[model samples]
Target: MIRRINDIVAKHIQGNLITYFFVILFFMTGISSGAFMSKALTDFQNKELIVYLKNFFSIVDSKAINNLAILKQSLLNNFQTGIIIWILGVTVIGIPLILLIIGLRGFIIGFTVGFFVKQMGFKGVIFSLVSILPQNILIVPCTVFIGVLGISFSLMLIKNKTRKNTRYSIVNQFFLYSTIIAMIHIIIVVGCLIEAYISPFFIKYISTYM
Candidate 1:
């Protein structure tokens, strides 16, 4: 089973190497930009962020987090992102938007980690690991995959548009695209559950000691 899965992943990667390369490069560029932005924060803004982080830690230590609320919000945010990417895949003109979404996700993550580490050093790194890393482990990959697929699909549509008679059935291609995206949605759901349920416990525990 593991080998089968590995083979499947390898084949997919081989098929989309160029797309993945561009998508990943774009994501990394966003991350770099976000990290730069974090460093560019004014002293007042830095202090404000520090205060906010401390307040958040206090809340976690006090066990005041509403898990259900977190879950609902996480689901809403993740699902909306997924749906947008899925829709954009179908709209060839939305290629830029799809890349922007992916880049924005990377930027957010980069800023968060950059700010944490820059302000708090090692402790901040530990805090980020517990609080931010869990869900993002899945989320980051999902965003990248979605970007690659969206771009690839959009390119395919563009190619088809220029053709006198397309070789593949658009309906069948769309169904496959939709199906893959639906599976990604399931992964996103799991990631949200981890964010809402599992990460909190780790954050709460670390908050007390940190």
Candidate 2:
């Protein structure tokens, strides 16, 4: 069973290399642009985030003060959505659709972080890391999984491998990929919760001393 899972993972990685490259490239470009932009808007963005945080802290109940669980669950929900998009992309017209879906996801991350870093200066970069890194660590794997599954299906189409139980192959692939995606979602949520409640206080203290 381990070997079988490994084989599937290896195949998925090899197949999706091209798509991964494009996605990474686009994401990096966005990050670079966002960093520059963040520098331009540092004061504004910092002020806004600070104000927002203060407001959020004010009315939030003591129970809600510990929002780690909610943040974690939100990350998991996001990953599950990615999994759904991947499954949909496997259908007859789903290949390009998957690419579009992944691309958009990457774009949003790039844009937000880029704008953030650009606006905050070095502190902005630090803030971005504190804010997005935890969730992103979870998201990257999910995105890669989607890319691999999409590529695998595309390969099947190109090679005309639709014979001798093609339906079974499709079903198996979907099941396997979905399971992995779900697992990733769970892991990410757990990480997010920790980061949300715990990291902020530590980060804020550290920033003050620095």
Candidate 3:
């Protein structure tokens, strides 16, 4: 079972390598954009965010776990939304549209992380990880699957890859990809639930010094 699971993961990693690179590239681009944007808006938003954080910390004597939970839940929600958007993009405008959407989402993430990191220093990294990483664990896989599936489908459409068999191969691939995406969605939902209900307290505790 272990070997089988490893093989599956390895296949996924190989198949989705391009998508992964795209995600990373998009993230870096977004970070750059966000840095510039943050410089303009930091004066206002930073103070506001800090004030809010202070107030939040002040109120909760024991909110560490609760804070982490909230952060986790937010991440999960964001991931699920991304997946839904990807599916919609594929259904409405096909693979090109789906890739576009995924790329835009990646950029947004990068921008947000970059902005925060620039503004907050090391603390920003912690904040970003807490805010983004939980759901991202689920999201990266789903996005890769979506991207790979989109590219595969687009090629099939363009090349008439299955003219003789009516493209059953492509259809089968789509079904498999959709199934995997759905499973990822379920995992994200579960993670969100745990984060929302349990993470806040832990977060509050850890962030006290920050």
Candidate 4:
């Protein structure tokens, strides 16, 4: 079963390498830009920001362990994002909007990772691994995949159709695409569990030592 799943995933990724590459590039640009900005900040500004971040971290550390609430919040947020992406994919003018959202998500993630890594160096990387990477490990790839697929489907409407294609064919493809999104939705929920239940504990443990 595991091998089969791997093979299926491999096939999907292999078939969309270009799309994946561009999506990855878009995300990496955000990361790089964020890191550069972090690095370029004045020393005084950096110090002030670090102080704020540490205080924020303390607040998070002191929060009660409420996995259920966390999970619900995570799921709701991800679900909303997924639905918006899907809805945008169905519209003619949605291509740019989809890209903007993807870029924004990437920017936020990049800024977060950059902020920590710059503040604590290697320790920050460890902190990010524990606190940030768990959910994003699932989310980032799935998000890119969905974005690529959504763009591909949306473009079908604008493409000059050959004789073999019909509206019904596109409709079928949309349904198939939706089914894939549903599977991704389930994965997001699992990611939410990890983000809620596991990441916090590890992050707290890391913080105590840091």
Candidate 5:
């Protein structure tokens, strides 16, 4: 399994190795900054963090866990993210923007997880697992995959546009590319459903009883 995962990753990152490496570095940097920021909080700030988390979790009544509004919001939010990547992915101009957006997304994940872990201790770790891990586990990989495709497509576009004898027609290639991106959007929707419908249920149970 480990070797299979390595092979899969190696294949995805193969052509765009340097691009992915720099993207991963940016993500790790964000994660480190978030962890350090947690450690640097003043005592009062730490207390405030605890209070904020409590309020965040407690805002909705227990019954609201399955609320349709919440699900709609979650789905829309993730949908927007996926769409952003999809649209930007088609243009050579969007390469740097895509990388920056990915970096920012990672930063947010790191900051939220780091802050929660710091405030709640072991429970923070548990909460992070239940609340953060499930959907993000899906979304993160999707983002990475999208980035790889975007970079690859952009490079292909540049080569095709500049080359004297282009091997593949741009129009046909784009139709197939777009079809795959649509499938990605469908996957993002699934991730959103899991985040909205499933993650909260586990978290509520864990926080209350465990």
Candidate 6:
């Protein structure tokens, strides 16, 4: 099973190497920018953030996290993002926007980890591992996948612009695109469940040490 999956992935990557490269590069660039932004925080801002982190820890230690609220927010955010990317895939002008969205997602994650490590050092790393990494393991890949799909679809539309009798082909491609997006969202739903139900426990456990 693992071998088959690997073969499939290898084939996909081989076929879409340029798209994957651009998508991954853009995401990495965003991460680098976010980390730099974290470093550029003023002393006052750093202090304020430290205080906020402390309060967050306190909440986790007290087990005060509202799980349902978290789940609802996660689902809403994930689904909204998924829908946006899916829609963008159907429009030629949305390629840049899709890439930008992917980059922004990376930036948020990079800024968060960069801040944690900068302030708390090793303890901060542990805190980030428990609180942030779990859900993002799923989310990061899904975001990139959707971004690639969006860009690819937009490019397809542009490529077929001069061709005749392509309406049926476009419709077929769109259906396939939507189907794949639906599958990606199912994975996202699982990621959200992990974020809300499982990560909180890890956060609560680690908060005591921090």
lDDT of 4 by residue, 120-164 (tens): 889889988898899999987778878877776677756735446
What is the TM-score of each predicted model, taking all chains together?
0.93, 0.66, 0.68, 0.85, 0.81, 0.95
Relative to the unseen true structure, what is the C-alpha lDDT of residue 101 in candidate 6, on a scale of 0 to 100? 87
lDDT by residue (1-210, candidate 5, tens digit) is 999978966886786788778767766776677777778889999788788767766653344565477679977777676677767767778778777777777777877888877767788788889888998888787777777677667767877877775555777778776787777777777788888888888777776643
lDDT of each: 0.86, 0.61, 0.62, 0.81, 0.75, 0.90
lDDT, model 5, position 121:
77
Residues 1-210 of candidate 6: C-alpha lDDT, one tens digit per residue: 999988987887798899999999989989988988999999999999999989888877876789899999999998998899899989989988988988888788889999999998998899889889999899889989888888899999999999999999999999999998899898998899999999998888888888
lDDT of 4 at 199: 91
The C-alpha stretches of model 6 lying farther than 4 A from their native spots are 1-8
Q: Model 1, range 1-210, lDDT digits (tens) per residue? A: 999988987998899999898888878888888888999999999999989988888777876779899999999998888888888988879888987888888788889889988998898899889889999899889878877888888888998987775655877888898888889888888899999999998888888876
Best by lDDT: 6
Q: Cα miss at 181, model 3 (Å)?
A: 1.2
Error of 1 at 65 (Å): 2.1
Give the best candidate by TM-score.
6
Instruction: Please report the TM-score between candidate 6 and the true structure.
Output: 0.95
Runs in model 3 lying further than 4 Å from the true structure: 59-76, 79-93, 115-119, 161-164
Query: Which of 1 and 2 is ahead in lDDT?
Result: 1
Kindly report which residue stretches of model 2 are placed more than 4 angstroms away from their true locations once superposed.
1-11, 29-64, 154-165, 203-210
Clashing pairs in 2: 34-114, 35-118, 38-118, 38-119, 39-118, 39-119, 42-119
What is the alpha-carbon lDDT for the whole of candidate 4? 0.81
Model 5 misplaced regions, further than 4 Å: 1-13, 40-49, 60-63, 164-168
**Best-first order by lDDT:** 6, 1, 4, 5, 3, 2
User: Can you give the lDDT of residue 33 in candidate 3?
Assistant: 64
lDDT of 3 by residue, 1-210 (tens): 999988998996797677567655654554466556656664778789668766766766453345455656566655655566545534524655555566666666766777668656888788778766765676565565556555554555556643676667757766776676667667666656545654554455556666
Per-residue lDDT value at 165 in model 3? 68
lDDT of 3: 0.62
Off by over 4 Å in 4: 1-8, 41-48, 61-63, 160-165
- Tens-place lDDT per residue, model 2, 1-210, is 999989977886686678677656644554565555545556767689657744543444222345656575666667565666666655656666666666556666666676555445586577667766765676666565655565566556555554775777667766776676666656656656656776555455535432
